[model samples]
Target: MKNLLIKLLHHNTRILQILLFFDLVILALHLTFGSTTPFFHLDFEQNLSTFYQSSKLIGFGMIFFLLGLSRQVKLEMKSFILPLALGLIFLGVDEWFQIHENIYRVFELFEWLRPSKVVEASMSMGYHSSLWILYYIPLFLIFAVWSGYWLRYFQSKLKTNVWVIIFSGLCFLTVLLMEILSSTGSYSGATYYWLVTVEELAEMLLASMLVFIGSKILSK
Candidate 1:
């Protein structure tokens, strides 16, 4: 696996290029044809864009897992990367399986347990966006801690990649919070549709950037 990563880094840089190019395609297709064109699907469901994002996340999980084993990585870094690898894999599974979407259903059985604001917002969003964010608080805290460590770790060592990584983190975190916020306010069909499009696009680009950062670290 380590050898495979080395080969990928040595052989080409087109992988991320293709990712960004398709990201552009996603944008262009939306701008020209809009969501209802049937020429492409960007709905927040099982579709091309969703599958692409899931694949990138799962691929990153594998790469991070391999990095945890690489001789080049420090022992302490290995400790963090190993768990980070697992978290990424689980997130990939969540992406592919829609675990977050469904988990809210199970909890919804106990509406008494749901917060009032979450309950109110769920009624409006047509899905349990607030509850989803509510349940994710713990995980988000851990992610914050992990990101803080990553930021500190790379600040002095990988100066070149630090800003890229920071930008990626900010993009991701912003979109993360936007999940619930985007659901607020009655939007026109086009407005709501494009909002989701933008959020999902940010997710894909963040996944790509993280994968690029992981590859750079693996090479080091």
Candidate 2:
């Protein structure tokens, strides 16, 4: 049991590192290229844009996982700075691309946000300032951190579970196929709204590669 646990940690550490590295690169691109506009148009609030924007913070947690996997450095301000700086670059480039290409993307700065307040006031709830930040900022952070841990946990648990791994691999492939099908504009249903953009798919793959490759090198 002890040896099995050790081996699982080892394998998971490798997988997590690679995922984090790739996630960072994708995040950089996301920050650089921007998320799809459909995401931002959430009626009650949730949408693709929110997913796109929020995923970047997950990228940060990926970096933290990488640090833990490598075990070369402790988490600190200096360590955190690079990901944040890289993240800024990611957002900057994305915003620039949208503007330059006239891609019908809207850039909403933090100040311009009003959806939550509207939702609360409309619901007749008292405005809690903490709720505002909690809804947006810290929520993303908690999610990102937990997601990083979860990925590592999943990888560890499934390392030797080949059938489960294959199933998940197929599911990811299915997602790609659906995205391709939806891109044709023929599927005008609710599922179409959930379809992954080509950009998002590409970023996911790219980020996965970064995580895999970086961890492999560091682990060696």
lDDT by residue (38-75, candidate 1, tens digit) is 54556546666667677778877877798688887789
C-alpha lDDT score of every prediction, in listed order: 0.71, 0.42
Q: Which residue pairs show backbone clashes in model 1?
A: none
Question: Each model's TM-score?
Answer: 0.80, 0.29
Residue 64 CA error for candidate 1 (Å)? 2.3
| Candidate 1 residue-pair clash tally | 0
Error of 2 at 16 (Å): 12
Q: Highest lDDT, which number?
A: 1
For 133-163, candidate 2 gives per-residue lDDT tens digits of 3234454475357435544644654465445
